[model samples]
Target: MKIKEYRTQFINALTPIYDAGEAESFFYLILEEKKQLKRIDLALHPDLAFSEEEIAVWNSILEQLQQEIPIQYLLGKTSFYGLDFEVNENVLIPRPETEELVDWIIKDTATPRNNQGLKILDIGTGSGCIAISLAKNISNAQVFAIDVSEKALATAKKNAQINAVNVTFINQNILETEDLQQQFDIIVSNPPYVRNLEKEEIKKNVLDNEPHLALFVEDNNALIFYKKIAELAQKNLVPNGQLYFEINQYLGKEMVELLEKMNFATIELRKDIYGNDRMTRGSVQ
Candidate 1:
């Protein structure tokens, strides 16, 4: 069928689950990935048709999309911080909010005031998005990433290779670790901060499809990862070194308090484009 006709069908199939605009965007995204054709290309060549096999392949993806699987997983990759990252069910899909956290880090590291050869560690790095992006953006950065899950770390290593950035990958659970052997100029983590009580607030697509281990914490200990990572940072961070996090929006005050109690200096919380408290930074004095 013609491109526009298929586009209409694709949107109709997904509108029940996603909004009209989102559904339309999904169609164009899949089109570019599967057929290498842009929206304007389809519009210019309205007669461009999908072959029988192509239609079958697209129908399979549509079925998965209807099942609430994320489009990023369907495409097997996603764009983060202006770079493409490979993703799977093993790791949480990188979000725009996380991109903002990355932007904050990049902006800091790229400044002329920052020293060269800055040592950075990304705790619980999934898909190596943050670590890779930092290494790619800050040419003199010495970056390392760690994750508990072997599967997730494997995927992250592959992503680092794909992105053409050198990021040291380590396999270890942050909670169980006692010390970081080496000091770092920065320690950043977007760890499992979502409380169990907040599961109901998560979208069906995210809750059902994303890796829960990378997404949640016990409600009673919602700041579990933050506390652990902060404790590590106290010893591992060089004097005046920075710590950053992609924080849970509802826990902004709690996060600030936690950092303050830990003696993290100059604590700052920043909002994302949507005006949610999505990023935080502090210096270790």
Candidate 2:
């Protein structure tokens, strides 16, 4: 089938589940990944045809898309923080807001104001995004990451190796853990802070496809992970060491208050591109 005709069919098939714009974008993304064909290539050569075998494969992906399966999982790989990562059901897909959090850390560390050779730890490092990005960008810093799921840890380890950045990956549940054996100059987490009561606010593509263990907490105890991580940071952070979190937008004030209650000085709350209160940071005295 000609490329343009194939795209029309793909969009028509997906329009029931996704809007025309999304379906059209998905088609282009799949074409780029599968055939290495960009929009320009197609525009210049509209007569490009798919082989019978390619048609069969496209049909398989189209079926999954119609069911609302994430295209990233179908591709088995994704770009995060300008690095490629292998993702599956075991880990949560990295978010753009998390990338902003990483950029914030890198900027602060690279400034002449901060000392060199800083040590950092990333709790709940799904896909190793935060830890690996810090190690790659900061250059002089030592980075470590921890996660509860062994499967998730395995994925994170693979990402660290692929990025050619050395990060110590550990397997441990943050909630049940009490302390880190070594102190860090910075401790960060994009922990599971979505309350179960906020289910209606989440899109079906996320709630149905992503790993719930990495995405949610019980409604009554919504701050469970944040509290535990803060307690550990109090014990593990060196003097003036900073703690950071990619927070739930709805709980920005609550998160800042929680850190203040723990006596974290120089507290700051920041928003993401969407203007939601998305991250919080503070220094330990």
- TM-scores of the models, in the given order? 0.97, 0.97
Total clashing pairs in model 1: 0
lDDT of 1 by residue, 127-205 (tens): 9999999999987889999999999999999998898889999999899999999999999999998888988999999
On lDDT, the candidate that comes out on top is 1
The C-alpha RMSD of each candidate to the native structure, in angstroms, is 1.0, 1.1
After superposing candidate 1, which stretches have Cα over 4 Å from the reference? Answer: none
C-alpha positional error of residue 128 in candidate 1 after TM-score superposition, expressed in Å:
0.7
lDDT of 2: 0.91
List pairs with backbone clashes in candidate 2.
none
Residue 272's lDDT in candidate 1: 94
* TM value for model 1: 0.97
